[model samples]
Target: MNPFRHGLLAARTAAVMPHRQRQLATLSAEGNAPLSVLFYHRVADSHPNDWTIGCQRFRRQIDYCERYFELIDLAEMQLRMERGESRRPAVCLTFDDGYRDNSDFALPLLIQRRIPCTYFVCTANILNQTPFPHDEAAGQPLAVNSLEQIQAAADAGIEIGCHTKHHVDFSHVHDERTVRDEIIHAKSELENLIDRPVRYFAFPYGLPEHLTQVAVDAVIEAGFDGFCSGYGAYNLPGESPFHIRRFHGDPEMARFKNWLSFDSRKLRKNFSLDFRLPASRIPTLPVPTTMTPAFSVLG
Candidate 1:
């Protein structure tokens, strides 16, 4: 196998093992850890050109989550965490990058269901009316909601979070000042426009090692209640509020089932075995790559 494949398996295994142990611990513990999941840039409808879930698949996923997990808003999740309350396998819904379809499509569905959600918007994109780099690269127009529309969503009971000013990767950027600017200044912009406190932050393109400790500290210093990352896991009590992990949803039902049943222990064991192999051999192996964005509706 190629080194890339082997490395990928090793990485996956490393993540899964610890997660599995944690899950086993949770099962044996007094209460289940409250799970707060985060999603990014969902597509409005399934189309041949889009990388997001189609409308039907999106509905089914939402239905599944709602049925299995007690759907709670971010504020409730935060309050419970702060109060040291036990959460009963509840889920908090979040969408990142202030996609316009969030307003056009997601908002209505959420409102119709009376489901509350938080949307993290990148202020620069909304201000400049520009598309994200990936979208631009893919020849797709910007699909973020406008300032006015966001305010309206807020009026309709949706919460807004900050997703940085320019969507720059904080993990890759070196300048401390720039990191602060991206996080702090972006919070200011959103707070001003929304006429409310912007307390939550989500890292743009959140990956492992994406945001530096310094950047996370800066976000806390900037007065955010907490922050989120794109890593797949549930938040346990006393977790660093600034680096919470989230899972991505697939358009396929079977994939979603695996994600829901995903035990950190099993993951860890699988990862341990994979990590022992040559990095080159990992990708070609029959390890489940469903979690990756290969079949992503928004890819």
Candidate 2:
């Protein structure tokens, strides 16, 4: 929010205004405008850190989204993708690491507004009432969400997803057994706590290098409806809907607007990882009770 950074963003916005219009026009005509999934970590006014955004700023962003975008959840986003191209751009809001501070304002606001969000939590932190390693390393050591809070969120209609047991970076994890334990067991533990089926999994430190074939394969084998990566990218139509791409929802409104506005440079940036899995390997998302699995490709 410094003046120089503000000026740079303004310059970028001016430069891309026309291009954004044309880009949206073309994509709208094509009927497959990209979907944006935004992720935030914490929402509070105290003990600020890289992962935290101020409550007022978070509210402003939500208001902006309410005005300019179609706010949907992951399941609805996937349903839209399945039905083929959509005419308008849509967004899904998600939070990572399950910080305790979100219960202060962010969660209550979303619940009151009836907005759809996926809240991903690391099981070990909640189970042990421990702080995230990153937060501890930053010397802030903020509180993490408790099991009761997570249950409350779920009961209020927020979708709780898994972020592994310990938030282990998959890039450094090579053993398949370890990956399976982290993912599958995490899902089971969360489900047990929430008493519902956990349908999604998000990779911790979700960059291309922070992900691995072993982890993604475990995600698929575990039958998660979809998986998410968090290195800031858009999820385009006609691509694999199962692999949800997300951008950072930091406090900077200019950057958030730029990313959602189809900034040409942002669109050109690629953040995909090649899992080399065949079509049959990727499982289909959940359907009605009468429906059966077709073993559709994950693409």
Candidate 3:
């Protein structure tokens, strides 16, 4: 364990945590409380990068999450949310940018355990076998999963969703055409590839500022199950479809436990569960007047 991380966590625990961990102890009927959707990018044994987690650590996390709370996929989580089922805490394992190591390492283990996860794929990269710009910039360009492997994973019961065609940023996209091509058309393209209806849509670089009402409108027009934002928050039992949230997973056991147990909602400002149709009611985000968010890397 890194002493620096320990000290920082201790300091934050003193300053940020509440007197009571009501986030954990509080619950709804039947012992359920809320939903946590953990999103990962890659899982492999070698060529480690900022986005990659070793296979062993990934397995241990799955084991731990299973022992503590119910492990579910996006579909089930939505179902539970609609049914008002929050008797026990639930988590969904989701991966962004479908990488080939997912087929080689992650798929077999998930298949064996019969645990379900959703893979958000950038269709253009998979078709072209080029690295995403983010990975390229990070100097860890890795092989992404092929069409056959993606379809095979789908065949083995893994949910496939769109991560946009080029992994384009939506925050600045003001026009409707960009939304149609990147968000709408990409979903159709992936559906054609897998021969199944792709329901979920995850935002590329999913921060609050990276989201725009235009993209949300296009996703609604295309009719998806839900969309995801990556800003260290959990889903209360009855959240709207478009306001789905995501959390980053850590491979280090101690750090992972701390992240999983921490109530990110405490960091949320003006967050609330509004389950209205036409899907508007995403919680109002704090206006980014702070210089802090630029350096913060939650996802």
Candidate 4:
């Protein structure tokens, strides 16, 4: 950790956390506490990059979540929101970009603790045993997770989410065919490998600029249970839970606490994306056996 950076974050969090805690308490009592969905990319100590966090720091964040918030899976969190019954401060953990190193420590710790974590993977990178393009550009071609690792994660009760076939940014792609291939075809391939319905999807880059209505429609049409974006916002009660908004899980303990502890500045600026999906569209758990496809085969 950079001492100067850490010191600043520590001082900021210390100064405001008590007030933030009080605000959170009031929100919780009013049954309107915002749900925090945090997304991480990699967890390791060697050759750390902007997206990587050390294993020790990762564990500490998990411990902090256990102490202060109700940790729930994406499914349960959506359920509570749909029912308008989210009364407790809660968090859902997710990892973006499948990394082999996470299998070494981070994933195992979550599994051991029975924590709900959704691991999103770019299928082509994992399938071809290639590094993500961003990593290659950074001169650190970190190893991608293997299919066996993904299957094992699913078997261990971790939700496997799709991050597209090649981590395609939806904002750049406009055609319907490409959208279907990335959203629908990718989900099909991943489910085949894991032998379970791959329910959630997280957008690559996950910011407002990285999204398009076309891609969002494709995701909805493809029958995904929910989709996520990482634009540093919170999901509140009475909103459509299908579009999950996530904050970046930075490595610094103070930064992580400051963001998750209902930081007043962030809370004031937080706004939900208008996916235009209604609460009625929120997919129900244990989908009925008699349910039929929403659409027939596409050309």
Tens digits of lDDT, candidate 3, 27-74: 544544667789899999889887899998898888777766667667
Best model per TM-score: 4
TM-score of 3: 0.83
Model 3, C-alpha of 88: deviation from truth (Å): 0.6
- Model 1 residue 275 lDDT? 12
Tens-digit lDDT track of model 1 for 224-260: 7677777666654443333455666655555454455
lDDT of each: 0.64, 0.81, 0.74, 0.82
Candidate 1 similarity to native, TM-score? 0.75
Q: Model 1 Cα displacement at 106 (Å)?
A: 1.5
lDDT of 2: 0.81
Pick out the ten consecutive residues of candidate 1 with the lowest summed lDDT: 273-282
Instruction: Name the better of 1 and 2 by TM-score.
Output: 2
Greater lDDT among 2 and 3 belongs to: 2
Q: Report the number of the highest-lDDT candidate.
A: 4
Q: What is the lDDT for 110 in model 1?
A: 75
lDDT, model 1, position 272: 13
Q: Sort all candidates by lDDT, best to worst.
A: 4, 2, 3, 1
